[model samples]
Target: MVKVEIVEEKDQQSSANSPYASTSSSRHSSQESISSISSELSAEETLYDRINALVDIVPPATRHRISTKVSKAVSFVKTGGKIMGNIVWIVTTSALLVGLPLALSLEDEAKIVAQEREMMAQQQGAQQMLSPGSAYPPPPGSNQTPQKGIVPPGF
Candidate 1:
């Protein structure tokens, strides 16, 4: 049962739009009321101003309750931070897991390709060694010497 009288003070009702004033009883002695009050005031208020006012006048016990609630909420939110840390480790390990095998397999494919190229080159070299005698056709009556057996390198 809080009773309020708008005194002739300048800044008295300045914070009237505050939460305490808005949420509490508006027992403001109106201009045409039983007890004729002097100044005429409008009732326009915003939520922040009201909340600030309530915080200012809150009793110690109620304030403690509010503080405890806020702390609990903060700790709950930070509980997810632990999971986030683990998630980073999981993601990095998974990426390495996927990438390592792929890189190793690609290296194997490259080795196969190189081995195939070496085999082809060796086959071409062997063919060249086996087939001799070039493009100079005997002019008129030129006699050519016969070539010998074609043995590969390590034989």
Candidate 2:
């Protein structure tokens, strides 16, 4: 029983030191500090207002020069973009115009090649058929008199 009591006391002490321990005063102080910091920041001038204040310190002539430079830069960017777009359009149109005819010509050439190959094959077959060795020899007793202008079997 005594040991159990001592363990309970130790558990309480350990929990008090742990982060999960909720102390109302500490939470209130943290919330107060956050609110104070937020309020202080809100009281400061906005970024745009600060920039305008800084710009006010510059001489009028210098400000005018800076504005002109900025405007020129913007216009240059716009003009470059337009020029690039036009170039892309021209190149695309040229490719389409040139590629169509080239593709058609290539197709025609391929067809011509195929036809030539077929003709060559047919000529080879005909030559094989006309070759004397391709025919069977005449039967043993079927000899006929040879006539003038007639080609002989071996010829």
C-alpha displacement of 6 in model 2, angstroms? 91
The C-alpha stretches of model 1 lying farther than 4 A from their native spots are 1-77, 133-155
TM-score of each: 0.37, 0.49
What TM-score should be assigned to candidate 1? 0.37
Predicted model with the maximum TM-score = 2
CA deviation > 4 Å runs, candidate 2 = 1-44, 133-155
lDDT of 2 by residue, 1-155 (tens): 35543434547777779776766688796887787764332446786776778987999999999999999999999999999999999999988999888999999999999999999999976775555443443435755333356453577
In the predicted model 2, the residue pairs found to clash are none
Question: What C-alpha lDDT, on a 0 to 100 scale, does residue 69 get in candidate 1?
Answer: 100
Point to the candidate with the largest lDDT.
Answer: 2
